[model samples]
Target chain A: MEIKLLTEHYDKKEFRFIEGYKKLGGYETLKKAFSLKPEEIINEVKASGLRGRGGAGFPTGVKWSFLPQNGEKRYLLCNADEGEPGTFKDRLMMERAPHQLIEGMIISAYAINSPKSYIYVRGEYNYPIKVLEKALQEAYDAGYLGKNILGSGFDHDMDIYRGAGAYICGEETGMISSLEGKKGQPKLKPPFPAIKGYLGQPTIVNNVETLAAVKYIIRDGAEAYRKYGTEKSAGTKLFSVSGNVNKPGTYEVPLGYPLMDLINNECGGMKNGAKLKAVIPGGSSAPILTAEEVQKTTMDYECLAQMGSMLGSGAVIVMDDSNCMVDMLKVTLHFYHHESCGQCTPCREGTGWIHKIVSSIVNGEGRLQDIDLLEKIAQQMMGRTICALSDAAAMPTLGFITKFKDEFEFFVREGRSKVKEVRAHA
Target chain B: MFKLSDEGINFVKKELARYETKRSAIIPCLYRVQKENDGWVSPESVSYLSELMELPEAWINEVLNFYTMFNKKPVGKLHVQVCNNISCCMLGARELTDHLCKTFNVKPEEISEDGKITISKVECLGSCDTAPMMQINDDYHENLTPGSAEKIIKGMLNGN
Candidate 1:
C-alpha cells in the first residue's frame, strides 16, 4: 500500500510558507513528541524499522545509538545537499514543507540531547535555502529553535550552512567537515562523526527526509507508523521519478510497493509507443535493472540488494526504448569525473580513466577490449576510497556497460549516439 | 590603503578585526569581499586576508580553490551558472547550457565580450522538481526550456 502520509499537504502551495504550514497541523507533532521521553522516541523509530532514506538504508535508530554518551557538544546535521543524480525528493521536501523539517529537527535534537543543529544545504538551493532560512527565523521567533526550545529545558541552535556546491558533501562526515568551515570533502572513518566530528565532538547526521519522518514516527507511534509501508521498511518514502515518464515528479509510496504500480499507476505510463528499456532503481549509484528485472523488483532495501542494486536516495530513473544506454553511460561517467573531489587516489584517478575510456568509446574510438576494461576498472574502484562515493561511481559504470554492451559497441563502431542519431529526425 | 565601497570595506574591517589573533579570514572575510568586488574572488583581497587572519597564504589558496562558488578567475558583469548536476542533467540542462552559449555566442566555459554573460557548469541547484535549471546572478530559473533560456538571457542583456 502506498502511504502519502508526509506528502499529504504537498499539493497545497501555501505549505511553502510558515502560516500555511502551521494551519496544516504542521508543528503539532513536536508538541506530541515533547510529551514523550526522548528514549521512548528513539525506541519508537527503532521499532518502525525505518531505514535511512538517503541511499545507505542503515537503521536510523542504530545510527542515533552510535552517538557517544560522553557529554560532548553533540550536533544534529541534516543532509539537505541532495546531489544524487535523479534524486529531487529532498529538495521538494525542503521547498514545499520547510516547517515540517524544522519541527522534526527540533524534536530529533531534543531526543538526541543535541544543542546545535545545522542543515548543510547545497549552495545551489536558492529557493529551498531561502525557505528554510525563513522558516528558521520563524521558529526562532516562535521560541522553537534558539535557547530553550518551547521552554522544555532544551537549548538547540539551528542554522542553515550553504555548501559551496560539492556533491561529496552529501556524505554525512563530509557535511561535518564543511560545517566546521573546512572544504566539503569526506573525512575517513574509525572516529566517525559520532565520535570525533565537527570540531571534535559527537555528531548525529540524518537526511532531511529522515529527520522529518521522525516527527511522524513520534506522532503516530511505531505501530501506527508501521500500518503504512512494509514491516522492515516502514513509513512512506518520497521517490523522485524521472526520465521518459509521462508524469515526472515526486511520489510518496510505501517501501515494499511494486515498481510496476509506481510506473503505471502513479507515472501515467511512458510517452508515445515506447516500451520500458531499463530502470536505475535508486539514484545513479544503484545498479541499472532491465525492464524484466524492474518488473520483478519491489522498492525496498532488501529486495534491491538481492537484485544486486540498492534503494539509494529513492530516485527511480525510468528509461524508455528510445534511450541509448551508451550515451547515458558517457554522461554518468562525466558527472562522476567532474565530482570526484580529488580526496582519495582511487576515485581521483579511476573516475577520470573510466570517463576517458567511455568518452573515447562514445566519440567513435572503437576498442573491443575497452568493454572489459570498464568492468575491471569499476571492480577495482569499489570500496577503495575514503567514502562510498568511489563505489557510487563504479556501480553505474559497471551496470551500464554490462546491461547494454551492444549499444556501447554500436556507439564505438559508429560516430554518433545510436539512439540520438537515429532519432534525430523523429 | 585601497578603498572598497563604504559598506564593503567596513564589512571587511569588521571581519578582519574579529580575527585579531590570526590573519586567515579566507571564509568570513570573503563574504564581505564578494559584496565589494562583485561575486568573483579577487586575488589581492585573498592575499590581504591571509595576512589579517594569521594563517598562511596557502590557506586562502585552498579555500578559493575548493568551492565552485568562489570564482578565482574574473567573470562577466553577471555570472550565469547552469546547474548540470544529476537532476538538472537529466532534465535537459545540457540543452539550456548549449542555448546560452549559442545566444551569447560563446561556449559553456566562455564569457561574452560585452561583459554581460559568463556561462559555466554548477552542481545541483537543489530544486529537483523544477529541473533543467540555471542561476543568473543569484536568482534561480527553473523548469527551463530553450525558449526560456533565450528569454532569461534577453532579460539579463536588457538589465531586467
Candidate 2:
C-alpha cells in the first residue's frame, strides 16, 4: 500500500504555492519547532530513524550531530542535483511542494544552528528552478524566511545555486566545489562535509526528499514516523519506476515493501504482458538483479545491501525480456564516461575503455576475449577513486556481464543482438 | 568586443556580491553572458567578463569549460535537446532523434541552414516516466511520438 506521509498533498495543485500550502496546514511545523530547544529537535530527529533519501543512505540525525559544539560558521546545502538515471522523484518533489522543502530546510537549519543554506539544483531543471524561485519569493514575502522567522527569533536565509551539466556535482563535496565557483570535482574524505565543507565551514548536505521528511518528523513526533517502515529503514520512500512497466511513474511506498508487489499491484505489471527479465533495484549504478532475485527482494537499505546492491536513490528500472542486455550496458557505460570528472584516473580511463569495448561489440567487431577484458577492467576500477564514479561505472558493468554473459558471448560470436533482429547501437 | 548591456552589467555586479566569496559568482555570471550572447558563450566574452569582474581569465575559462550547460559554440535560435539515456533509449529515443534530424535536414549538434533549430542527443533530463522527451530552450516537451515531436518543433518555428 502507498504511504503518503510527506506526499499526501502532492496531488493538490494548491500544494505548489504558499497560499495553497498554508491552507493545507503547511509551515505549522516551523511554529512547533520554534517552541522547542534546538537540541530537542535534533533528538526528535535522531529518534525518528530517518535515513538519507539520497544514494549514500547515511543517518540524517547522526550527520547533524557531527557538527562541533564550538560556534563556527556553518552551511546547510540541499542536494537538488538529481542526475542519477532512472530517478525523477526529486524533480517531482520540488515541483509539487517547494515550500515543503523550504520549511524542512529552515527547521533543519535551526537544529544545526546555521543561518545560511543553498539548494544546489542541477542546471537542466529549468522548470523546477523557476517554480522554486517563485515559491522562495513568496516565502520571503510572507516572512516564512528572513529575520526572526515565525517570531521564533531564529534567523535563516536560503538561496538557490544552479549547477551546469555535470553528474559528478551530485556528490556532496563536488557540490561544495561547484557552489564555490570551481570545477565540480569530488574532494578527498577524512575531512568530511559535516566537519569541514562549503568554504571550510561545518556543512550539512541533505537530499531534497530527506530534508523534506524533517518537517514530518517534527510534526508527527519520532514514534509516529517510525511506525511505517521497518526498524532500520523507517518511513516512506518515493521510487521512480521506469522502463517497460505499464505504469511508469513515481510511487511512494513505505520502506520494506515487497519489490514484486510494487510491480504487480502498483505498476500494473509489465507493459503488453511481457515477461520480466532483469531489474536494477536501485539506480543504474546498482548491480542488476535477475527476475528470480527480484521476487524475494524487498525495497529497503538492508535487503538490497545484502543482495550486493544498495538502495540508491530508489530508482527501480524494470527490464522486460524483450530488452537486450548488451545494448543496455552500452548506454549505461556511455553516461559514466561522459560524466567522469577526470579528477580520478581509474574512472576516467576505465569508463572509456569499458564503453569502447561495449560499443565495439554492439557494432559487431567484438572478440571473445573482450568479454573477459571487460570484467578485468571493471574489477580494477572499483575503490580506486576519490568518488564512486569509478565504482558506479564498474558495478553495473560487472553486474550485466556476470548475470547475462550469454547475451554478450552470443553477440561476439554471431555478430548481432540475440533479442532484436536489427542492430540497435546509436 | 563582447560587452554586456548596461542592465546585464548591473546583473553581473549584483551576482558578484550575492555570495560570500566573489569567486562564487562565476557560474551565474557565465549564465548571464550566455543569455546575452546568442545561446552560447564565446572566447571573447571570457576576456570581457574577466575585465569586467576584475578576475583572472584562467579562473573564468576553467569554470566555463567545466560545465556542459554553457555551450562553447553558437547554437540555433531553438536548441532542441533530446534525452538519450537508458530509460529513454529503451523507449526508442534514438529513433526519435534520427527522425527529427531527417525531417529538419540537419545533423546532430549542427545548426540548420535556416538557423532556427539544432537537435542534440543529451543525457537524462530526469523525466524518465515521460520517456522520449525533448527540451527546447528552457521548456520541456514530454511523452512525444516522432510525429508529435516534429509538430511541436514546427509550431515553435511558427512562433506559437
Q: Please report the candidate that would top DockQ against the real structure.
A: 2
Determine which window of 10 residues in candidate 1 chain A has minimal summed lDDT.
Answer: A417-426
Q: Write the per-residue lDDT of candidate 2 for residues A372-396, one digit (tens) a residue.
A: 9999999999998999999999999
- Once all C-alphas are superposed, what RMSD does model 2 give against the true structure? 1.1
Worst 10 residues of 2 chain A by lDDT: A417-426
TM-score of chain B of each: 0.83, 0.97
TM-score of chain B of 1: 0.83
Candidate 2 CAPRI grade? medium
Give the range where candidate 1 chain B is weakest over 10 consecutive residues by summed lDDT: B17-26
Which lDDT tens digits does candidate 1 get at residues B35-118? 567667777877766665566777667766777777776687777888775556555777778777876787665667876778
Give DockQ for candidates 1 onward, in order. 0.40, 0.80
